[model samples]
Target: MKATVYVTIKQNVLDPQGSAVQGALHSMGFDEVGKVRIGKYLELELNTTDRAEAESRLKAMCEKLLANTVVEDYRFELEG
Candidate 1:
């Protein structure tokens, strides 16, 4: 199985890098884009068939170490 996790800052959070990227894009003539935010994407491979258990473990993994829940939100997709 494979899991792809995305972790990003909640709205109202500061994202300097994203802002920089947006500025660069504007300078490069991509003016339609605004309020860009950055995030982390993690891909994991697991050897398991139990979907529920794997999701539980994956949630725990995010809560414990993969993300900082205090200011970040995360979502994951799993596929076999």
Candidate 2:
């Protein structure tokens, strides 16, 4: 199975890197761009075929290492 994860900053947190990118875009004539946020994407392969087990393990992984629970939120999709 393959797991695709997206990790993003929580709405209440500040994102300096995202702000910098937005500023650069505006400077380059993309003035319509508004509030930007940065995030992480991850792909993992697991040996199990059970969807329930995969979801459980993925959630654990995100809580433990893939995402900082204090400031970031994560979601994932599974594929075979």
Query: Per-candidate TM vs. native?
Result: 0.93, 0.96
- The TM-score leader among the candidates is 2
lDDT of 1: 0.95
lDDT of each: 0.95, 0.97
lDDT of 2 by residue, 1-80 (tens): 99999999999999999999999999999999999999999999999999999999999999999999999999999999
Worst 10 contiguous positions by lDDT, candidate 2:
49-58
Please provide, for model 1 over 2-54, each residue's C-alpha lDDT reduced to its tens digit, 9 standing for 90 to 100: 99999999887898999999999999999999799999999999899999999
**Which stretches of model 2 miss by more than 4 angstroms?**
none
Clashes of each: 0, 0
